[model samples]
Target: MKNIFFILLSLVFTSITYAHEGGHGTPTKNWSFVNNNETIKADFIMKVGDMVYLSNENNEVLTFNYSEFKEQDQNYISEKANFINNLNFTKESHRLKTFDYSILLLLTGILVFVFSLFSWKTKPKKYFVTYNLFSASLIMMGCANTKSSKVLKMAANDIPFLESVFGVFNKVNTRHDDQYFYVESDGIPEHEMMTGITNWQQQVPVDHDYSGNNAWAIPLQPELAENTLSTKENFMKGAIAIAVNGIPIFNPLNNRGEDANVIGELDKWGGHCGRADDYHYHLPPTHLQTKVGEDRPIAFALDGFAVYGETTEELDENLGRFTSDSTYQYHAVKKYPYLIAAMKGKVELNPRTQAPENEIMPQAKTRGVRPDLRPLRGAEIIDFENPEPHQYSLSYTVNSQIHKINYGWDTDGNYNFEFVNPDGTTEKSHYKRN
Candidate 1:
């Protein structure tokens, strides 16, 4: 009975110690002190020897001896002081589970176990037990830590994948609250903008902060709607999704229901400047594959589905399909309604084709016409290519004849465009860089 009791007691103590190391306690909040007819509310900042430091609303610091408060209040202060002291020690204990320290210990134990397995035939029974025990102990300790639970929860939230895909935009500050994933950006693309366009409406991509605190918030876990909305004539919205780099992606079709790519408004990267001076994509950001990876998600749709690279396999009418595990996702394609043919998941739509009176082109507006940039009327895209950085070639068909255009900045920083007609005649236009 005595041995059994000792074992149980040790287990309880071990669990308590592990919990303390993993930050187990409710943080103390600001408290109010009642002294006769007066009440003073302040945060219990710190304790120095017998004095307690407190801060008020106006950032005024006040110090008082332990005995200055009433007996009950004095007891409460003593209890809080003890907790803070214990928290300091607990912080030191948690250092064992820090990323660097934990990785080192885990790797060392794994290497020992691996070596032991290779020499198992000749190794002593005690050596095998010791090596295996060491590795197992590290894993068990890691599992006992709440940090491991946090890591697991983050994985469940799909944070690792987001970090990998959206890391390039970290400078713009990306974060998540309980319900929404917030991203703040200047709405500018790192890639070159508006290279081969003859009529440049808003040539410069301006900065717009859509961090979602007051503007846009993407649902963390999007719920699928019973009735999915199709991407059709009436459903055309300004931006259906946002790229990881913070630039919004509009519908492939313009307000007139014509393909934006065919209309020759987008640059070589399938993006152009908006009326609000915002740079965004109207087609699949295929050029981003070299940066974000071909297999990984290139953009996240408003419906909360990730948009991946195109595949030869056929998808549903919405340009979306499910993963092997039945996780629904959208993919970019070469055809019309490229990024998303329709919203597969649930989303709130305004149903109005025009922006609200007070609207300022939000980063994730569900329904509104993209800024009307009139494409060279009657021109249909034949082909668009980017042979090198800052260089672009566009082919279009007008009046039953094919025409070619090559446009970019020359080595001397001169903006130049060469237009060739089917008759083998060429026209050149030049502009100075601002």
Candidate 2:
């Protein structure tokens, strides 16, 4: 009897709360995804990290990954949410808008008082049936008053804070509105590369297209994930973060889940060229501490948290800790999980992907001019030189025998390659960028 009474009582409070929540009569718009053919109607509410909240005609809440929406809908959702969230109310005015619990007490007290009078004027047995109804309604009102408010407070001036972090670097460009900060670059660093790589994959660095729509994005007001997802056996396909010098940073573990740095696949500065000849780092670029400062962040994770070089304090299970300002940050350590153990902030996974091969959405893509290459056994990248702009040469050794590749590109996007074999045989090839 008590359980049944509570259920009825709770519905009354819920209905009342939703009726006054300001979205009651709002019209919903059709929303579709890049992958899904079906569309749903929902009213845009807000963007929290990588997720967006919406409401239906019934005012019931719904949420989806932000990247799941089509390009145009994404713009609308972000813009609409910005306009709504910006209309902040003063504390005094806000307090007035809050639901008044006194009315609930008064209404329920009247119902109970009226029933009490009827019980006293007549046989109490007849009124016993309604006692549960009145008592439960009063209890429900009390519980509703204690429920936590759903209003989420976003971190303000995040764009300015991030600008300060990347301010010292000249190779990267940044811009933002209200939701996200986008960074554009060529995906190559200005520092020395490939000289310290003991294990060679027969690949050399090249400029990759990472501008415009393919630019990297970081959430401005990052939110914590409901459940922390570990980095192990995940985020292997794309970069986990990007260094301040415009270089992408991949997981310390290679796609096969082995430590790429410990396995001798990375150079002294912790970077290497991929199979696509696109350069990125598999470990923390702590060497950048010389430029960005030891106490500062050398990179920013895709989840929007800063990746600091070294810290004296201990880290949590995720290799991060909440700062004195109450914000979270990850540290770069010398051991395993060099930068991040798990994402400290919320992020969206590619909708078409699963685990291991799955990567974060909104990241830039790499375009290669040549076919993907395989590892050359016993090969070591001994030297890399950019004799002039748009021209580069790489030297590697296999069994102490020197081999070289001289490559360059022209204004027409035509690439010319000359390969010199260890036996002094030379071959030439050409490709046109599409």
lDDT of 2 at 97: 41
Count of backbone clashes, every candidate in sequence: 0, 0
Top candidate by TM-score? 2
lDDT of 2 at 365: 91
Per-prediction TM-score to the true structure, in the order listed: 0.47, 0.67
Cα lDDT tens digits, model 1, 296-353, are: 8888877677888898765665777777744677888776667677677777665444
| Clashing residue pairs in candidate 2 (N, C-alpha, C atoms within 3 angstroms) | none
lDDT of 2: 0.77
Worst lDDT 10-window in candidate 1: 148-157
Q: Write the per-residue lDDT of candidate 2 for residues 1-434, one digit (tens) a residue.
A: 66766676676666467435464575559998999799988888776545677777876667788899999999998887677555532433443444456356546756775776678657575455556466556645554543433333434426666787677788788888677788888777888788877778777777877778888888777777644555775788898888877789998888898889888999878889998889999889888889878888888888888889878786665778877664678998887777788787878999887777678877789999889788888888888898997788889888899989999888777889999998889999998888
Highest lDDT: give the candidate number.
2
Q: Where does candidate 2 stray beyond 4 Å?
A: 1-157
